[model samples]
Structure formats: structure tokens, C-alpha cells
Target chain A: MDSENLENINQMLEQDAELREKIKDQVTEFDKKTRVMTGLLNKIHSTPTNQLPALLDSVQPVLYSCSDVTAEIADLVPANQFWRWKDTWCNSLRNAVFVATLIEFLRSESLMTIQQVSDILGIQPSWKDRFVLTAEDYLHGVISLVNELSRLAVNAVTMGDFEQPIKISNFVKDIFAGFSMLNLKNDTLRRRYDSLKYDMKKIEEVVYDVSLRKLAPSTRDA
Target chain B: MAEQPQTGSLKSRTAIVVVFETFRNELDEHNDRRERLIKNSRDVTNLSKKVIFLLHRIMTEDEPTPKPNNDRASRAAAKGREKLKEVQNLFASIRGEVEGDRFWRYQRNVSPGLQEYIEALSFAHYLDTGALISFNQVQQSLSDEHGVPYFPLTLEDYLLGLSDLTGELMRYAISAISQRGGRTIAREVCTFVRSCRADFETLTPYYKELRKKQAVTSQSLQKIEDATYAIAVRTSEYDLPPEMLDDVVAMVSGS
Candidate 1:
């Protein structure tokens, strides 16, 4: 090959490397915002359920700022090349997703849909020629949400909220049953799914402890 | 402690089930597509390897020295080109599977086979023309009848594949040097390999794996230089006939 041809190839590769460096910078900024949100959410384990609304309200500004950083990341990534640079930011994105899912659950005691998570993160849900949240990332986020909920269940009982454990137990079981319907391959998702049963067992034991002591308020009161 | 909360929980539970059902379908479709691409890539790799082997056999079968216009050399090039059609067909069959954004999604699954195909194609090109194939030429060969490319050719794969070509060239040069009237071809290959190594050195820092492949290229260059130097030394020392010199060089190189 001629010298000009080799020079052109090197130029293209150098451009790709430069773009990656730019994207990585934005991802680091995105990661910093998520860590702040995670620190705020960690307080939910100690706060009583009645006080959760105020805690979630405090996270809204940070979450919006996180979405702003995500926009910067989206602008840096070239079209149709999300998967090429995905490795740089996927773990941080998954953590952001988990934070969003947990906040939604604490606000309404319901699971967040993938579309809703995408809306919160201000990214597209479609896997086309744009920056998008992949299904694998969403699933990983939900698995992490389950893990956090189990920890919440144990701490809720410690705070004299016996009924919260029962709710978390039932919700976790329903989510586990949903995961079972999936035909998972032997990948990172499968390994995470396999470890999910331990979390399920932990939540189940919290429910068992509360029920054995008749700590739940009598249903006749309804 | 209200009946409304129980009903609300039941409603959300059903919503969770429906949402996960949709996720299951999406995951299944993705897994199936990935599996298909992986299988096709393996088939491509196998076919490309056979093409490389076929070219090596045909070009070196009976000729003591390769000539640009030799009847056997042209026949060997023709046979290699014909065999490569099967490898091309394998690539064409998977073109739709990697269309648009999907190409980047499954690029890892496709890269190994694509790199092997590049190696075989460039080696064949070198055998026919006695020169390195250009990147555009390799990319053009992967396009369709209307000149539409199946997917963009990655520069990393093209470079790595060419690095592998040095190994084959080393084998070809050493084998040829042991044959009668093969000294000129050996010196020519030595210069070509040296040029390839010098050019590739500038690219080592940009590609992580290319640095590793560069190590292998250095070894190949060393062997070619050593073999050529031995021949030069022996020829300068003795004015022996070509056939006897061939035996002496062959015995000395142990090839």
C-alpha cells in the first residue's frame, strides 16, 4: 500500500480515539452525579416510610442534573455507534438506572417501566441510530433494585415498621417470579439472576420474623 | 391498614408480570440473533482458512520459483480466486443480519471471521501481484454488485489481518529460498516484509492488540533477514552452481 493510504487509515483511527476520550470525560461526570444520587438514596434504609416523600423530593434536582450530563454524553457519541463506546459508560449508566428505579419504587411502591426509566434519564428507549438505554442495562438495574429492596426490608422492621417488610417480601417475590419467565443465557445477567435468590431469601426471612411475632397490625382494623 | 392498599398492590403485581413478559420477548429475540451471528462467523472463519491453505498449496506445489507471468502462477491465482468465492458468499449471506446499527451491536461476533477473510484475501493478492493489497481494495472486495458495502470495514481488523500475512510471507520466502533459482524472490520478499514492519510500527500505540502482533511481525522479519543473509554469505564465498548452492543453503537453514 502507498504512504498516503496508510496515513489516511491512521488519521481515522486517531479520530476515533479522540472521540472516545471526550466520551469518557462525560461519563465520569455522569458517574459523579449518580454517586450523589446513590448517597441520597442510601438514607432511605434508615428513614421511616412517612419521611420518604421528603427524601425523594430532595433527589429531584440532582436527578435532573444527571440527565443534563447524559445529554452531553449523547451529543458526544456518534450515531449508530452506541455499542462501540458503550463499555466506557455502561456500568455507570446501569447504576443511574438503578437509582431511578429505586426512587420510583419509593415514591409509589411500584416497579418502574423501562420507558419510564428512559424518560427519567432523558435518553431514548429505541435501539436505533441514537443514544439509547439497552434492555440488558434495564434488566441489570432492576436486579440491583431488588438487592437494595431486600436491605430496606430488614431495616424497615428495625424501625418499628413491621408492615413494610410484608410489602417488600410480596413485591420481591412477584419480581422474582417475573424474572423466572425469562430464558436467560449464561452471561452477566444470568449470574446476577442466580444471586437474586439470596436477596429473596433475606426478604422472606424478614417477613417470617415479623409474622411470627404478630407485629403486623390486625387486618380486622380495615 | 386499609383494603385499598391491598388492591393497589395486586394491580401493580399484574403490571409487573406484563412488563416482564415484554422484556422476555425482547431478550429472546436478541439472544437468538446473537447466536446466529456467532455461528455464521465461525463458518466464515473455517471457509477463509481453507482458502488460505489452498492458495499456499497451489502457488508452491511444483514451481521452484514464482514468476509474474508463469503459467502455473496465473493458474494458482485463478484457483485461489475461485475458492475465495465461497468465503465471499458466506459474508454475503450475513449482510442483512448486520445492517445499520446492528453491525456495531454484534461487531465482536463478526470481527474474528472478518479478520481471517482479510488475511486470506490479502495473501492471495500478494501472490498474484507481488505487492501488498490496499485497504480500499480489500474493502471493495467485500461490497455487493451495486458497490454497496455490507458493513464498514474496521481499520483494526484490516491491520491485524495484514500483520498475520507476515507469518505466511515468512514461510513462503524461506521455502522458496531452498529451491533452485529462488534467491531473487527471497531478497524481494525480505524487502517487502521489512517495509511492512516499518510501516506497522507507527500504528502500534493506537491499537492495543496491534502491539502484540507487531512482536510476531518482528520475529518473521528476523527470520527472513537471517535466511537472506546466509544465502548472500554462502554465494559470495563459493562460485558453486545454482542446484548445489540450493542444497547447501537448504542444509544450512534446515528447512
Candidate 2:
């Protein structure tokens, strides 16, 4: 490959690792918050009904924030590749179900509302579909950066992995589910991300601008 | 003469009422139909469970006495039964939602469906990359992988660019309906818009092609549009920035 094509191909692979890493971070965050909420759910199960809302309130932020991000992360992967999430998407998808159920539970006055659970579960596929595409651009790009070193260990030709290769693979079974897409040529990808060496200088500007924070938060802002 | 003048005025007034009533009735009708679609989807989903229960009962029953030494037939029957049951349920659930709702609700709800559809976008990317290299190999070597080039100049990317032409027609229809305020045209526009969402795969390549062609084609198109807008509306030509509006027009035209 010419230097430019090599560069383009390299950029593609780099973005893939970056995307994976970003998702890993988000997933870790998701797991941490969910573990806390899961424990809280158990506590609420025992607490008097009157104290339940307070209990639920504490987890609500976690659920909503986690969900919003997971949904955002879901954008990183394709809805069709819901499988790439492997166990991660499973937990988060279920977590979303639980949170959605919690929302229903709150409204149901605590009577074990399967209706809400089922409703959330039913809509799970739909929600997954909507958020998957947008997420992949973000996901693959971030994952590539996180694993840049691991990638270069191999060669692009006859190599198991490229130092930075662009990929978007889907398990046919997951053909209809999540973002399994990976590409190096997508110019419009990750244009919205406001992070990196560049955004570091803008941290002070971001804090004072509430609207900016609302749209996106740095690791520090989150 | 006075009577004729009164008749004309009365006819005009009635025409006005008819126009007003058509819009009012159409909007109300659309609203009612949308509600019905939602309710029908719910009812179908509920009905699916009952059907599943019946299928399970039938499947669990003892096999027929004639048990043709092979279990394959019976097993295949059971599997088919299960699959059919799922299909029936799926259709029941989505039937109303897909077929009956008015245009606005469809637009609102359709985004979720579009999201799902677009999520598989990487597949297209993968295919394009693989095909590009494979076709290049076939053409370069004239090897057994023999065939015309994949996504050749006039093939893959061409259709991709051409879809932009359709999208422009779509935008024009939308603006026309919005400006004219009649369901007759609006209904057609609604189909155009919904097709943009529902049948995206059919359009994806075309849209992709259009996007590619945009780089070269947009400059001229924008100049034409800007000049037209400047003269027709007597607005400042500078208001519509060339690069921005050109792409916007290209995108709108593609959809």
C-alpha cells in the first residue's frame, strides 16, 4: 500500500481499538453502578414500603445515568451485533430492563409489576436497534485507541490482527440486532466526541458552560 | 345581476368551508387511526401468548400411535409448529402498528425501527471493503474469481450517488405538501418519507453514492440554488453559505 492508503488503513484499525476501549470503560462503569444498585434493590426488598421511594431514588440516578450511557454505548456497536457486547450487552440490556422495571415498579405502588418488566423487555430489541448504529462509530473508534499497542504486535498481511485495522463483523444470527460494524473509511464517525488531547485545554470552558456539559461530559465531568 | 354576484360569493364561502373541513377531518381521522393501531398492536401481542400456550399443548401431547419408525417427521412437525406460532404472534403484534397508523405517528415510531436498521451498517462497510479488493483482484489477474469488477465506476458507487436524485424528489414532495396543506399530496409525501425510513436498505447504497457524488456536484447545485433563492425571494445571496447549503440540499435530495 502507498503511504497514504497505509495511513488510512492504519487509522481505521486505530479507531477500532479506540472504540472497544471506550466501551470497556463504559461497561466497567456500568457494572460498578449496577452492582451498587443491585445491592440497593435487595435492601429495598426488605425495607418498609414507605422507605422504598427513597431507596429507589438513590438507584434511579445510577440506573438513568448508566442506561443513558449504555444506550449511548449501544450506539458504539451495531444493533445487529448485539452479540459483540457478548456478556456485557447482556448485563446492560438486562440492567436496562431492570431499570425500566424499576420505573414501572415505582408507579405500580410496589406490587411486582410484570407488566412493566415485560414492556421494558419487549421494547429492549427496539431500543437496541435505534441506538446501535450511532454507537458503533463511537464504539469502534474508542476501542481502537485503547488497544493500539496490542494491535501493532501483529502484521496486517497474514497477521492475526493489524496494528490498527478497520473491521465491522456481524454474527449472522445477530444479523438484526446491534452495531457489529467496523470501518476505516467512515469520515463522519466520532465527529461528535469532544474528548482527547484537544479537549483537555477546554476543561475550564466546559465547566462554566452548563449546556456543553449537558450534551457531553468528560470522564471528569461524568 | 345582483343574484349572480351573490351566488359567486356563496360558492366561494362554501369552497372555503370545504377546504377547512377537509383538513380538520383528515387530521382527526389520522389521530383516531393512530390510536387504533396502537391498541391493535397491544391486543395482538396479548393474543400471541394464548396461541403459544395452545401450540405447547399440542406439541406436548403423546405422539401418534402409527409412530412411523422415524421421529424426524414428528420432530420437524413440532419445530415447524413452534416457528409458525412465533411468526403468527410477531405479525399479530406488529400488524396494526405497521398498517393502520397515520403519517405522524409512523414518523415518530419509525425512528426506532430505522435505528435498528442502521445499526447493521457495518455490514455494508465490510461488504464494500471486501468486494472492492476482490473485484480488483479479479480484474487485475483475470483469475477464476472472474467477473466484472465489484462496485465498478458505474456500478456500486454510481447507484449510491444516483439515490440523491430520488431524495431530492422526496424533499420537494415534502415541501410541497407542507406548503399546500392537503392530505392528497401529503399522503404521498408521507409514503415517501416513511419509505426513506422503513426501506432504508433499498436506498442505503443509493444514498451512499449520492454522498460520494456530493463532493463534486454540491458546489454547482448550491450556486444554482443560491442564485435562484436570491432572486426569487430577493434575499442576500450570501445568507446561504455555499458549502453548507449545498450538502444540505444534496442530503435532502437523497432522502
Candidate 3:
């Protein structure tokens, strides 16, 4: 009975080792594709989003590859959430990050220059904003997103870097809204910045009160 | 009728073809550039994310080094405080000898009106640092540092160093004025007491405004006291000016 039990345990160990080797190869393949897609998407983002197609015809291939990779990885892993301890190098987190990154890349490609962006939305351009601040419409839209992100990032870091699916979904919504704002579809979405406008009004009130009080002594002394 | 149909169709077809081709070429160029930038930026962002992940894995997952003892840290901090006090004392002594002589000489040159500003500064310093420092101390520090005697410094030069003066003297004078019962020194300080009251009153609005603005700056808070200081000090000691006190009080109070 003791000899038979030892044989069973050894057989289990051998089977586990073989399974891990197979999983390892799959993870490597996933990693390679992720990197390739990441690189191509980065190039896409670097171009002035509007003039992007003039540079090359590389996007269709990358888009096709992304779709294929997503399918292959889905089949390779069960539950599609995270890499097991043995497969920590590949994960659902990686896939989500990649997809989000592509979304941003698309945004950068479209909103290349503020002037071109501003023209689409039909706003007066100021020389100071263009030359001194170097602000274009697309740039301003990007800044708004970045500011919102940094505000949330601080809280996320303090909360042990835990992220829920809701956070990712919110990011997608914001990115979509931002692109719309860059184009002609901004009228309804413009109300989202109403709070900021309200805050600026409060600032103006305080500044006015400060100047008044500051002059009080001189006024009285005179 | 046959000739008309042919020319009309030819013109329309050529115009349509030309417009479509130009539009297509322009769009192709725009899309290409946009895609490249997006791809490049995404990669950089991804690389940063990966690098951060790698570093975090190293720092948190790797074994941690032990921290030093808290008792030892406290003892070291105490020693540092003592060393700092020693350095400040040394500077104070050197400062006194140098400023005393320089201020004494300048005292002879200024009008009696301006002379009080220097004295007020000295008295204010004494209240603040408990070091019995004065305006003369400032002149002496400069004179001794550079081995120059009685070199006249400009009013701008004097104002530039209002930090050291304000840190200690301003608080001392304001508090002394508020108390109003210390002695002859206190009596002299009381002349400026109205100013302090006015400043405290003025500060309330500024505080509310700052909160409303979601902003805070040192200058705004100091305005109240500075206004009071000017009004109280400017009031004549023996004789009150015509309606000036009422105006000053109103101003200081920010009414």
C-alpha cells in the first residue's frame, strides 16, 4: 500500500510540471503580441491625429492583430481575469491596460493640433493662447482629462491601488466625451465643466473682497 | 439636343471625379499622421506602466530592510536642536555689536520722525527674540562682516530685511499693545494698540474671502496688521491729529 501511494504522488508531480511548461509558452506568446501592438499604437498616437493617415497605412494590420490576440488569449485562459501564480507575467490587467492605451492612442491621433481642433468646434483663436501658452483645442481637451485623472490617481494610490471595473468604464466615457468635445459634438457635453465655471466665479468674488479690505486702512487713514 | 447632352454630362462627371480624388488624398494623409502619434504615445505610456510595475514588485515584494531604533532617532534629533540654538546665539552676539554702532551713527542723520521707525523696529525685535536686538544690530552685522564703518544704507536695503524684523518684533509689539499695562515700554507701545485692534477686525473679511476663493497667501493676512501698524505709529504721541484717529480706527477695523 505504501509503495502504491508514493507512485501516485510522483505521477501527479510529473503531470503538473508538464502543464506548467505548456502554460509558460502561451504566456510568452501573449507577451510578444502585447508589446507589438503597444508599439504600433504608440506610433499612431504620435502622429497629428487628423494628418495621421498621410504618414502610413499601418493601422489596419495592427487593428486586425489586436482582434486576433484578444481571441487567442480568451481561448488560452479560463475566466479571463488574471494570470495564475505560475503565469503572473500575463493577465487580464494587461489586456485592459492595452485596450485603454489604444483608446488614448486614437485620441492623440485625432486631436493633433489645437487650431485644427478649435476650427472644427468654431471658436475664436487668441494669439496669447496659441503663442504664449501653446494651447490648441485638442491640447486643452487632453489637459482636462489629465487633470481629472491626476485627481483620481491620488485617491487610487492611497486606497492601496485597488481599481474596480467602474473606474475603467468611467475612463472610457471621459475619453469618448473628450473626443466629441474636440469635434463638433461638444454642445451638450460642455455642461460637464459647469462646476469649474462656478468655482471660477467664487474665486472672482473672493478676489474682489480681498482688494476692498486691503484698501480699508489707506481709505481710513486718508 | 444631342450636342448639349454630351457636353453637360462630360463637365459634371469631370468635376465630381476631381473633387472626390482630392478629398480622398487629403484624408489619407491626415489619418496616417494621426495614427503614428497615437501608436508612439501609447507605447511610451505602456512602457512607463510596466517599469513602475517592475519597481513596485521589487520594493514591496522583495524582503524589507529593518528600520533603526526610535529612541536613538529622538536623541539624535535633540542633539541637532541644541546645535542649531548654539549657532543662532553666536550670530545674535555678532549681530548686536555690529548693528549697535551703525544704528547709533544713522540715528544722528535722520529726522526725528524717521528716527522712531528704527527705534520701533529695535523695540519690536526685543519683544520677539528676547535677545534685546535693535536696528543698530543690523548695521553692526553688515559693518563687522565687511569691516566697513558707518556706511549709509538705503531705505530699500533696510526694508529688504523686514523678515527678521517681522518674525520677532512684529509679534512682540502687537502683543505688547494688546496687553497695554506692561510699563513705560508698554505705554509707548499702546499708541499702536488701536492699529492692532483694527488689524484683527480687518483680518476677518480677508479670511472669509480666502476661504471662498479656496486660496491663501501670507500677504493677504499681513495686510490687517500692517495697516494697523502704520496708523497707530503715525498718530502723534502728545497730541492727537484732527479726525485722524477716527479715520484710522475705521480703516484698521475694515469697517
Which candidate number maximizes lDDT? 1
Clashing pairs in 1: none
Worst 10 residues of 3 chain A by lDDT: A127-136
Steric overlap count per candidate: 0, 48, 45
Task: Looking at model 2 chain A, report the run of 10 residues with the lowest lDDT sum.
Answer: A167-176
RMSD of 1: 4.2
Order the candidates by lDDT, highest first — what do you get? 1, 2, 3
Please give the CA lDDT of all the candidate structures: 0.82, 0.37, 0.36
**All candidates: DockQ:** 0.48, 0.01, 0.02
Per-model TM against the reference: 0.91, 0.26, 0.23
Could you tell me the lDDT of residue A44 within candidate 1? 93
Candidate 3 off by > 4 Å: A53-60, A66-96, A99-101, A104-222, B1-255
List the candidate 2 regions with Cα displacement exceeding 4 Å. Answer: A1-9, A78-87, A102-222, B1-255
Q: lDDT by residue for model 2 over B1-255, one digit each (tens)?
A: 222222221123233233324434544565565556555435443443343333333323444452331243245335434543443343334434443212223433332322211111211211123111222322222112344221111123223323232333233333433221222333443343343333334333334544554443344344334433433353244586434554565578752
- The candidates' interface RMSDs, in order, read 4.5, 24.3, 21.2
Candidate numbers sorted by TM-score from highest down: 1, 2, 3
Question: Best candidate, TM-score-wise?
Answer: 1
Which portion of correct inter-chain contacts appears in model 2?
Answer: 0.00
